[model samples]
Target chain A: MTTRSPLRIEPTTPPDESPPMRPSDPLPALPPPKPDPATVPDPVISARSLCVWYGSSMALKNVDIDIPRHKITALIGPSGCGKSTLLRCFNRMNDLIPGARMEGTIKFEGIELADPSIDAVALRRRVGMVFQKPNPFPKSIYQNVAWGARINGYKGDMDELVEKSLRRAALWEEVRGKLHKSGLDLSGGQQQRLCIARTLAVEPEIILMDEPCSALDPIATAKVEDLMDELKEDYTIVIVTHNMQQARRTSDMTACLMLDEAAVQGGHRTGVIAEFSPTEKLFTNPSDPRTEAYITGRIG
Target chain B: MNLPVPSGSVERPRWPAPSRFRRYQGPVMLSLLAICALVTVLTTIGIVAVLGLETIHFFRESHVSLPAFVFGTEVDPPKFGIFPLIWGTVMVAAGASLIALPIGLLSALYLSEYAPRRVRAVLKPALELLAGIPTIVYGFLALVLVTPLLKACFEPLGLKVDSYNALSACVVVGVMIIPMVSSLSEDVLSAVPRSLREAAYGLGATKFEVSTRIVLPAGLSGVAASFILAISRAVGETMAVVLAAGRMPNVTANPLRSVETMTAYIVAITGGDASYGTPKYLSLFAVGMTLFVMTLGLNILSGLILRRFREVYN
Candidate 1:
């Protein structure tokens, strides 16, 4: 419950420069080493040694990180870099794909999510997701928002929940007047906001968004970014984005991934983490050369 | 000075002359359009003219009472009427569709939603084989095998079953038309955008829920059209009904009782020796026209429903 902002003022290195520690600029110390399990506070989700493979090809390699509670963390990377793959692993969405396999552990609220005994349906109820494209069922706006709650056996004041969720998504004012209208009738940006509202109605602890604003215009993207900032007060948010500026604007922490060489047998692309740090530090003074090059637009 | 400058201004480049081949394009295109229009009009006129003239001649020559023809007429000698045949046709078609709809839709659901890609590839072609088998073969199988099996099943229940009855014909027709329903239903179900299913899955819906709630509703129009087409085929079916549905024109509700269908009656009178101008012979065209009108009506109704309810996801 502590908001500790320990500014780790590290020396900024150029993209092509060597890793030299400067005496004047004190390198920011990493967070205190994680406490033992007996004393450790629970993280919303902790992915340890997470690796994913499709058939013979590896998509994610040895990624270990903890997503803190009630904060927005953004994963920024180039295309085919496995950020989406890692986000999908949180809810086992990869299971739908043929030949997809995973190794290592994903613990959600201290429970091993990849365990065979885990019920995926209940797991998804606690961790809802919003895709890049706005896909509302060819149904009324009310029905679209009510779907997740109804499916999860929600037995509350549905009308209140719907209004509150839409308000939380910053979409109620525009859409409340047309609750009975088709979801598809809304503009793309409004539709996406409606999707966020739908996801919120389920009362999930964590909300995973995969480039939620990539398809939107600048104004729409800014609106969603603002919405994310407000939502972080109550919900843990994990988002993947190709836009580096979006990562800087909306995230408390940033993790940058880059594609490694393909596997010989299957030609499967593997992704490796280049840098993971506080957003301000990562964007202003990156530790890794690849991250510096990527943020500055010198290389993809 | 301005006018003189315009007159001596640079002359535009002359356009190239057309090739000889380009000259015939207009006539050729017009001729093609005329041929298409002529073919369409001729087909429509030909069908209407044949059905209309034959129906008129049938009514003029036939001495059968019109009321009895429409709604079962009982005479001293049990004179011919179309009401019993119409009843048999409707009964068989409706019963067959009832049996076929669930099985066909389930199989289609499995193909579209459950089966793996490789398995679906193999299963789809295998199911299509049912459509390729001739209708006469189904008629033979219904007569030779289905009739006996029904007798054994019904006799124990104290039901008086005829060898050729509506039950056998309907069951055989259901089996024969399974591919039509399944194939069309599969296409429609597959046409549903994958995004919809993914949306449902993201909402924590089970596969069964996604299929039933989203896929089925999205494809309802196509499924309805398939049912109507299958039923029309069942109604107009001649060889199978003639062989499996008995020739006796009994207006009974019991499916196990012997009955005659309109198509079966037409086959009966036409197959036997009869003078062309006689009342008995004119009865065939009347029955044919009635069957044609009924099937056409069903097709039109199905088209209307499809236009009304078909989902446009784009």
Candidate 2:
């Protein structure tokens, strides 16, 4: 493993130019009636009373969360806590699961995400996803980066776009000379980054990563974490992870989900958000006893 | 750490020593299984030896030369030609492929990608049952029904349709192999990881694009292998071709004309009253050897296609 510094020193954007805020950033939305002061001034995705079920068993129950624009928000929890489910709900990826049902509203950029008339395909184009497993298509590296854009009717200099996407994912420096090699030939870390580049090629506004480094080694994990830090400058990111250290290292906001022990019904445990706050505050001064217990390893 | 220390007071569990019968069980079972495996290997060797010896004897006969047998155009008196038989087999195999490949592939795509769970459970086995129907029955059906149907459809358009023709044989043979192609291809397509589908769907690709562009291309090696295997099955198909396609070994491309495939020729000559040591009797082994080589080559080609192009999934 190449032990490069985890902290990236150079900025891809010009030094004179800061991260651009959208015109919609000025308004502090007031729909929830009782807004948490810790919540961001603007949110890219807001899920209200989101409940998800897989067939007869419930997975998530009345969980509310907000993912702010151009910020990295980490969802951390133990197994079956539904952190991954919540992240999937942002892009409606749960729709792919058979018998998966969801109730409640997921508003993506002021539009109802669950509306039947809202094309999921079009929604996915605006909000791309990176899976827990690196799933590079069985094609050349160039094709892996270019295919999504090609199918989505991208009309531009494809070679330039591939280069830009790869560069943005911090993978071009290693793969620039072998652009035509199979994407599967890359190492696990590179494959995951390649997946990130594939997601970026579509120019999505938000990127949902589901434990993007769980299958990677620690060194590779740090590389992906570094890539995530760089990516949050241009794209809103919501990542589901079990590694609490990773959440603190890479995210400004963190939401921890826990099994609702008191709400256990018919032998099934529902998942609810135990705490959602700034990463530093949640780790240091947790208000909820359950959150403190979980943070201190007394319970999960 | 205040861990419990062993006091050496508790008795350890003990297992009994193996009995005399138990000691011999391993070698006994090993030899039993080894013998069963050796049976199949010996059977294949036996077949090859028989075919080789007879083919060599046929070639050594006074009037029969290896080149003349393979490349000559006559089959009577002095000349022994196998080209016409090979041509007929090729024609049937190619024509059958034209029918089976697209239909089989589409059926596989539908089964793997579009069919509901309940529908697939019932449909998959039912589709495989098509392969269970005896080939003799297919031959009879082709001779009595398919030939008449084609004649009725095409004779009106002033096209000559032979009572026993390669067209009907091709149709029946093609239908016979649809299950083989569809079943094999569907297994391959289904083996494509769900993560890849999710990846495509995540990129806003429609289900159609996911199936055709991603899943199909990912399993291209297996799909190509299935096609070759099906074509080989069609090449070696005997009863249906013998009954539907007449025993006339003519080198022609016309589907409406009568033709005899290699398998059909072997069947015809073997059933006829030719003397045991005559060239005619020995010709059966020669034709049998050709058919064996053809199918062997195709099977090896299929295996090669699978190994050479298979996508490794981690």
Candidate 3:
């Protein structure tokens, strides 16, 4: 019922018109602090100066981020801001697309993931993903969960593993009665949980979620966010979300990316990280004016 | 003063006014319904009347016993019967379907899953072109080209050669029906949601695993329907069999031996000069009726199979 206009920020003034703002602005005039390379936590996966191009168009520009271990990090941005594209880079899922090219170092577990020595199949097994929409194979619920383990050549006790994974996903009690039924027969929330169970069955060290709750109702979204909180005790999670509330609720760290109009080429566009910080600081007291504007619902 | 004046006001009608067009809606709808019912009944009656008359005339003039018409009789001129022709038709159809099913299904898999967009676009139309070629042309090709090629290929392998045999006819018929099977199976394969494939890939499964475990099983009913339809086409084919299957009404099951299907036998008998109201003349109708029954049975079987295992995705 209420329409709010976006807050527009003035660009940097030309040198001829006015002198540049002094080092002392109203906001705390601190220099960009660089974390000491030795003190910084060793990232399980890190991308340095990452850029992606589609044909002649650039989609990402010099994105540098480090994913800490055993924690949930959220990528929050407006639509078409390349959060999903950056999330997909962890396991090289972007390789499936045509005419997509990337220039960067994606180090997974201190090893360069994009190097020729790193097998894409093995990397995907180690880092699993759950999509925005609940996509269950047209199979029995049991088969849906067992498929990952089977493909990964797990020759262990599959029955126990399936049960354990389903229970971890908080879906075993509800779905155990109907394990033989088609996975597609479940409710939307149950299907998404089943997909999480399927991903967990493979025992991946890290999981990437691309707007996992965007297709679900509020209740389902709450359940998934709760699951993500529970999952972070064991697995590193990287989630892309447009819901700032969800990022505030579930993530320990948040990275906000915005499209960089200054970097656009011809008709092409690119996204750059506008801010990255602890969730509490980013939501309650963002340092950047643009970040403050976004968090306050003044601009998106 | 106003309230007192209102007591004497006349009442208006309770019903709303109807427009002229609204008043015509009921009668127009009823007339359309009547016309549709009439057309359906007339078509059904026309088919039953024509087939019923011809069948009765055929049975009356054939001089063949009813039991002998269904099974075979060892009478002097060998009374017309459906047992041998039905066996031949089933054998040819089954053999042809066996050959076409795997090839068509695999090719469909390639086109729908593996081929790039441009290659698929070109390949699909080329396969459909195979279906559009006239059956008469296939028959000619089977007679003049395929049979000789088969003979040449088989002579060195220590197999006897018949110029017109079930082997050549079935092979050619299978080739003729390839496009139907591939196109129908391709449609069913493509109808599977892309999310299913993505889910499999996300699980670290290879492309082959995804295709075999997910796509094929999902499309099984449609693929089975396509196979059944291809078999029905093969059974009902007359021109190819007539040209290549050598009109011998033998009850053998060997594909290498020359055989006559029900349709080919009917074609052979009808194409010959036999006086009207004679046993031989009536035999054509008997064979024609047998062919029709076989095809109808196949169609019903295919429909039942499709209904039984139809997959529902929501």
Best by TM-score: 2
Every model's DockQ, to 2 decimals?
A: 0.43, 0.55, 0.43
- Best candidate (score: lDDT): 2
State the local distance difference test value for candidate 1. 0.80
User: After TM-score superposition, what is the CA distance of residue A188 in candidate 2 from its true location, in Å?
Assistant: 1.2
Using DockQ as the measure, the top candidate is 2
What are the clashing pairs of model 2? none
List, residue by residue over A195-247, the lDDT tens digit for candidate 1.
99988998888999999998899999999999999998989999999988889
Ranking by TM-score: 2, 1, 3
Candidate 3 stretches with Cα past 4 Å from truth are A1-40, A116-118, A263-265, B1-67, B73-78, B272-286, B299-311
Model 2: per-residue Cα lDDT over A36-109, one tens digit each: 54667789898877777777667886677888899999998778889888888877888888877677788998
Error of 2 at A130 (Å): 1.3
Write down the lDDT of every candidate, Cα atoms only: 0.80, 0.85, 0.79
Q: Residue by residue across B96-173, what tens digits does model 2's lDDT show?
A: 899999999999999999998799899989989999999999999999999999999999999999988999999999
Q: List model 3 lDDT by residue over A1-300, tens digit each.
A: 000101322355321232222122222122233442322287788887677766656677667788878888999877787998898888877766776667767788876865645676777888999999999887789988998899889999999999999999999999888998989999999999999999999999999999999999999999999999999999999999989999999998888887664543234456777777777878987756667777788877
Task: Compose the digit string of candidate 1's lDDT tens values, residues B1-314.
Answer: 45544542457534557877798899999999999999989998897778778777866665556676677544112355678888889989988888888888999999999999999999999999999988889899989999999999989999988988999999999988888899999999999988787777777877888899888988888889788888888888878877888787888889998788888877767788466767677777777878888989998988887776655566
Instruction: List, in the given order, the native-contact fraction of each candidate.
Output: 0.48, 0.78, 0.50
| DockQ for candidate 3, C-alpha atoms | 0.43
